[model samples]
Target: MPCDLEMGLDNNEDGNGSPETKKIGGVEEEDGDESVGLSRKMSEASICAAEDDEDEEGRKIELGPQCTLKEQLEKDKDDESLRRWKEQLLGSVDIAAVGETLEPEVKILSLAIRTPGRPDIVLQVPESGNPKGLWFTLKEGSRYSLIFTFQVSNNIVAGLKYANTVWKTGVKVDSSKEMLGTFSPQEEPYTHEMPEDTTPSGIFARGSYSARTKFVDDDDKCYLEINYTFDIRKDWQSS
Candidate 1:
């Protein structure tokens, strides 16, 4: 898929190269599926086909918010609470599940680009327990988009609520720390286990999504991530 032309475009001109008379500063253009934030999730168009029609091919997927956890947290300056929560999550993130120490931070200067022959995101249907197809891009600097529907297992939703509660209660930012921290770490890390209640209530089973292109340390390597939370409790449904 092509990255939106507006990905890094200056707003001062139109597609035809005519200067825009508007002088608005800090003005963000509304993306076709604009509800998703800086990290675009999946587009509304693709979302409809995948969730509503049960046609899995309609959902295209990609890798992630490729920045080191730290950079991802810092990018959103306006959401102070979210920034802090992200930092805490990053500080405690376990990559490989083998206790490899994550780099404290990632800088564009450190990323090395090399061609790799593989697809990133894979979409699957739980009922089939098999992947439909892998999401791929023909080039490095391209945008990938898709719609995703997950049965929000109760355990996952509970974890989200707990995390939100922790972030909302008595959190503070400390500029001097090498890695940001929020609530104290629990003795045991949370599990990604689904609970018995995590079934399709038609409430949190499916929904619309959108996303934008993301570059991995380079200005060209692109990826995407979910920009907004789909609570499944209220707004979940096929688009």
Candidate 2:
């Protein structure tokens, strides 16, 4: 089957974490496998599966009561080692920044199309559906990747991941997810870049595709969800 096969991931050594789970091209394989990768194909066969009824709405699936950043720090102050570990997890976060809340809030600020040597096409993220209609147009058979800038607040977001399912003309094409390891709340936003990949080319590949993407934590708390559309064409759309 045609696919948007990823080459490899960046070293992501920014003290946050790196992507560990990559479900590429409508297939769920272990991370680092060579057969497939990120930027899964928008085809007509396999779409991402919802694990359970509750999982249908990933964000609403509760993992029970959780502690806030303030609560975590104040609870184990007497234990020196535990306190140090908490400090390490929080990194250099400002106490004034993270609010006193139960769940970590993640805001995906922007999504950019990164093509070699060209100016980035960045689309600012909204709460849900896109008001502008199409997100971007990628040149068929071009080598490009995607990057996301998001901020976390209140507490740590464990096992953060990116997952999206693609569709073309009501046919499910691909379903996949990538795991970006644990991240703590911080003042500056965190940036994650998917490995380079090439877009599929051919008469069939050039068309509009609709997709739904989610930024979710291990607890099934979805911070940001985007529902949008885009196109793959013989050439990039003119500005």
Task: Say which candidate scores most in TM-score.
Answer: 2
lDDT of 2 by residue, 1-239 (tens): 01232112222223433324433211244454432211111111112324331444465344435666676677747877657555665668776667476667788888887889879878887655453687778888788777888887776665577777678898877665656556677778888778777877788878988877777765666777777888888997887
lDDT (Cα, 0-100) at 30 in candidate 2:
48
Deviation in Å, model 1, residue 89 alpha carbon: 3.5
| TM value for model 2 | 0.70
lDDT of 1 by residue, 1-239 (tens): 11221222221223443222211111222334222232322222221222122335654444234333234434666777655544443344343231232221111111111223434333322232222332222232323332222221101011011010101022311000000011112223322211111112342222221221121211112122212111212322222
lDDT of 2: 0.61
Task: Evaluate all candidate structures by whole-model CA lDDT and list the values in order.
Answer: 0.24, 0.61
Query: Which whole-number lDDT from 0 to 100 does residue 151 have in model 1?
Result: 24
Best by lDDT: 2
Candidate 2 ranges beyond 4 A from true positions:
1-65, 74-82, 96-99
For candidate 1, the C-alpha RMSD (Å) to the true structure equals 21.6
TM-score per candidate, in order?
0.21, 0.70
